[model samples]
Target chain A: MSMDFGFDMITEDEYQRQRALYEPLTEAVRRLIYASLHTDVGADAAAEARTKIEAVTALLETEQRASVPLVHENTGRPLAWANPAVGLRNAIAPPMVIHHEDDGSCWSEFTLSGAYEGPPGWVHGGICALVLDHLLGEAASEGLTQPKFTGTISLRYLRGTPLGPLRAEAFVERTEGVKTFARGYLKDADGATVEAEGVFIRPAWARDAG
Target chain B: MSMDFGFDMITEDEYQRQRALYEPLTEAVRRLIYASLHTDVGADAAAEARTKIEAVTALLETEQRASVPLVHENTGRPLAWANPAVGLRNAIAPPMVIHHEDDGSCWSEFTLSGAYEGPPGWVHGGICALVLDHLLGEAASEGLTQPKFTGTISLRYLRGTPLGPLRAEAFVERTEGVKTFARGYLKDADGATVEAEGVFIRPAWARDAG
Candidate 1:
């Protein structure tokens, strides 16, 4: 079933508690994922693991499945688990901490872990593109207004983004009707590593979807 | 430990089988990940799931943790489960089936599922970039010679890549010394949705690493 993600019905206090309850579960799942990457035991050992997994799966199945929402209702809250880029609940996510500004802009800071490595001692370029798309999209809507979709994004890689702490910033350049132009860049301690610009649009149907 | 991704040591046959065995495991994990996204039960229900998870984690701990390889060793086998673009072992992967041609070019076909959706009816722009980056990188190397790192990639979104089966192609345009220039585009049933050009380089250090 389709569900609305606009946080109009959720309160700040309720959102905080709801997020708090699931943090540990997502963290555990993330650990399991990274652990699995390194584990491929003997057939006997794997059989044992499978048995354990089956039990967990059975228990999860007993409960009613909550329809997964791709976008959070209250976009302002650092609903870390829901987001694919910075969501802590997701193991694949870099889980950057994002901050929104009043001037239709946003910034995020995070350390790219070994899990995100692509090249030798460098973060994956595709991952960088994912982060920028999310950053610019958030800036376009400030994660508070009608959702804006990424119409187009162009990126330039100045250098390899080293696998460590990095900062990224996005600012809206101009808005022509429903299309908002935004530019963003990522920087490691040394300086800028990647720069991007994109067109984000609030389609006519976005309001109807919410 | 630093490992070489050069596939020189692997045979085509072994590559094929290794991928086959792991495909199911990745598919199971993918299901688990999506399943987890939909399950946020009460504390009691979650505790049961956690207990079962702990049991599995304990069993896995008995063995030495495998060093996760970002890139597979046998790069040319079209190992559907090892690649981030087509690797079935990783749920985050798009699992494209790629066919490499003799003329130093490659093509991949896959569908953008609900998991990869960004806009209402389109694939994520970053996902397109990710696929293009991989497509072009594969074209640059063709899984044969020296490793080529993504030096720079520029993308222009012609239109939204509809969420369904799509094809992407990449071919080397020209090479100047270590620099290999490549171009790629993604297409749905209708026509091209995104186009990209990138420079892949056989870095001097890449030789040393391999």
Candidate 2:
């Protein structure tokens, strides 16, 4: 089945402008999140901070979008500013920068702070799954040229991943008609900690468009 | 084979007090996140908001925890305030409250706003995996009477889960010594959109303690 969300197409200049507008804000919010967890401020200080934060929220709410806009760059790349994985405007996403290799593989190097801990100092297993899922989907999408959705993804946690500098990589294993199979892993300084595989399917609409 | 992070045990009173202090702040940050995405405020207002947020962060930084503490309720349940899935103090978490059923199953009902969107209005697939993994782990843990780490989890996306009210439920399918097999699904109003199965493994330390 096919579905349409009516994505808008924007000029490259507009994409760059939006990027410039939102990226730093997203970064600031990310720092706020990390601070919220580690902050040992007194109750009164925290309450006052909350009030300041709420005032900022109120000011922002003065003007709002009905829904997040789905736009495509003039170069045909999808630009989703609200995506939790890699959106330039999403503070919840890790500061991941995925590198696309010439051989159609994707890899990212990033750091996880205390916010991502699951087992004590180790990273959360679900966070590991989240990163792998996105990287694998990117590999399956072939740099967004195919635009596939995650059909099935599986992960095995070999050992605990420490919450610090980490690396993840994924590559398309094979493609069968509309579905692409991809595999990847998360690694620390020592070696692989989690391995993942996924199947990504090109939607009927995208296939039809092609 | 085993590890220790020196989790502290907190009194019920302390837990309640901490909860009271942080829950509202977490909620406020959640609203801030939503507003940050939907806000159409002019650049000057947005920049001003950033400055105010930075000030708050600086105030918080005056006192900070070296790392996120893994605490346990006096009654033994893990209390991870930084958990992205169910941390009461984590703003990045969608507001979810899991209810444990007598039959060893766990379920939660929550709404995903625009911040969780992946493909336009649908929830991010990685997010589905995140929630499912946590729910399934909770089920395997049997209300934290026994602790287990996710060994492997797999999900199949049957359809898109819209970004609104959704329900997720998980239960233990079986247990084989150190491993517990669990299954779960995410559903919108109409029906199930994603199905998942997971293996939760009791660490050697826990087994030895038993």
Candidate 3:
């Protein structure tokens, strides 16, 4: 039904490192949003919020995660190796949890809210891009084997992305050297109306070792 | 200072031909948006809406009417062409436009409102994509005789795009046959923060005689 070749990516160790690095932040974002919504607490809680936020920021201070990346033994070439710093407190995270991480792809889910609205009662287009960027960013990493920055992305809005609760899905479509192609969609319960395709590149500045 | 490159396009005649051939819904959109805001007034009425709202559509219609597209010669190319089709009117204009011709660089702008809100006070991300897609789709067509579909688009969200009036700008950077590399950014009026950046493409399926 669609033209997709599926990307071939990194290794299990790299996957774990990426997950451990991002999951905490994702979890923190989820918690912060929940607290912001559920608690009737006022600005005085701003300090409390900082404390709570710090609970998660603590993860970044712990240690530096290393990734050897994938390599082709015969060619003696480093297969894929790239990582970029995606600073904490991501703008979009409907409380996503990294569910599974296989060799060449990663899967996660998040909900939407009033904070991300645009047309009438729909999610803002920028928020849609934010969600997809992260999804595609993860997908582009090919399940942590290599990390890449989006070189390009295309989006099709089939229907209005309603506000409130929505979901997004992203996965790798294919890979050629440092370039990784991916696709993602964001939708309300029914189906996708906002779809995106992206190409991610592992920049030359990134670490590389065979 | 910015990353967009829209200074160079092709001939005005080719622009006219390209415009004639384009099928974007811009005019329809202008009419729809005008009607929605000026609900009780007819197009014949001169001073209908309040300052910021009145003639908004007419002004757009005028600009749409006056703007000249750049189309390539033997290899007619520019940055986007739209052949808008007449369409139905409603509360808000739909964000759809057909691009006719391109020379690889240009800029596009559109405004949305509560009609596209998802959050209580924020705009929807999907709507952002809609506008961005239209602009990128236009950029994708640049420097080529015929237009192209989006092969990929990448977006970066630097901050939350506030609700109310906003603008989108897209232009091409370079071209490589079927692949045209381009970037765009969406900025709120204050300009303090950029909601997003986009890198879009023109697919091979859309290529025509150079």
Candidate 4:
């Protein structure tokens, strides 16, 4: 049984082209989602808008891929264009962009809009879990040079994360052979709203490849 | 301080009317997201589509709400229109419709598409977390009558959940005071792909109200 997670390898130039192409489209779609939620348009106008959206869908579907391709730069960083956490093309993602520190930690600062609400005015707890999981995974992967899958993750919600600008950071707490234990938090201006700890494991194939 | 989670109260008739209006819009936007991921249209066409989408957004925005309203039936079931898990108006949700069994368990059957992919073709681990969290929360709430917030939830990924038709279910294992312990799984055709356990806490306000 092969555990080869097929990734599309592309040059940096090609990665840039696709990113440029899809990022804005994802943004447009994101705005479309937000508008759909808050819109108070009359039924006739709403119907008209839906028709226009349907037309766009048809145009885009004219040239469709069987699946979203996960692209990796020849240099090794992953550009998973369809990833729900940080995918450049996935509108569902808050599209967190992580920054790797010299100290082997990762952090991201992003904003959540109305589309992610769970409670009336707060960011959804699951969405928080999604962001933290991705951050911890990035930390566990050690800059995406070594891929790791999340084995288990636990979160404690100390306070509600308000729907606005927020910060999340994760660091490798330790590594025991094939597994890496990492910890991180989601924060607002006051302090940590949610704290998380996760165990990420390197698959046998990845370990063997390494 | 009052912990009143301000939920808009509406009649069942109003709920039905809003559901009729937004459900199809959400479905359309969901298809738009799927199309965005799979689309391989020419640059010119993509740009043109963006223009049209922007126009639709503007039209929708002509009448907008200050925030996404969380509505509840005057009879008490939450109709969180903006919830990322089961919101009728949220395109980001797989829009899971949970079925509560007589024995206090909840299950949802839905399909995830390219938008939810985390690793190549498989469903993202964080997405699994999101789904499980919502499912377990539903169970803890006991059919949205007794509201509880997720305090801590843990997940163990036994295998990758594929981005296709899938099933998820959760049930309350026990409850001690204000805390409910629930367990659930995400499954593909074969068997359980991910298993989860969660502790959901009924807020002091909810407790007081009860």
Chain A structural similarity (TM-score) per candidate?
Answer: 0.82, 0.90, 0.56, 0.92
Q: lDDT tens digits, residues B1-210, model 2?
A: 346656667788888877777788778888888888777776788789888889988987898876645455654777767888887777878856889988999999998887887777688888898889888988999865576889999999998889889999999999998999999999999989999999999987778788
Candidate 1 collision pairs: A7-A73, A38-B66, A80-A87, A80-A88, B81-B88, B86-B95, B86-B96
Per-residue lDDT tens digits for candidate 4, residues B1-210, read 234465567788877876777788878999999899778886888898888989999998999875634455564777777789888888999988889899999999999987898776678888999999999988998876776889999999997788899999999999999999999999998999999999999887667777
For candidate 2, what's the TM-score of chain A, rounded to 2 decimals? Answer: 0.90
Q: What is the lDDT of residue B53 in candidate 1?
A: 66
DockQ of each: 0.39, 0.72, 0.04, 0.74
lDDT of 1 by residue, B32-79 (tens): 554555565678767666666666666655664433443345553333
Index of the highest-DockQ prediction: 4
**What pairs collide in candidate 2?**
none
- With candidate 1 superimposed using the best TM-score fit, by how many Å does residue B147's alpha carbon deviate from the native? 2.0
The regions of model 3 sitting more than 4 angstroms off are A1-92, A101-103, B1-183, B186-210
Q: For candidate 2, lDDT tens digit of each residue in A89-175?
A: 777778577788999999999988877777777787888888898889888987655668999999999988998899999999999
Clash list (residue pairs), candidate 4: none
How are the candidates ranked when ordered by lDDT, highest leading?
4, 2, 1, 3
What's the DockQ of model 3? Answer: 0.04
- Sort every candidate by TM-score, greatest first: 4, 2, 1, 3
Query: On residues A1-210, what C-alpha lDDT tens digit does candidate 1 reach at each position?
Result: 132453334556776665665556666665555544446565566656655665565565565444343334455342434455765545455666778887768999988764555654677787888888888877887763556767778788887788789999999999998889999999998889999888887766665765
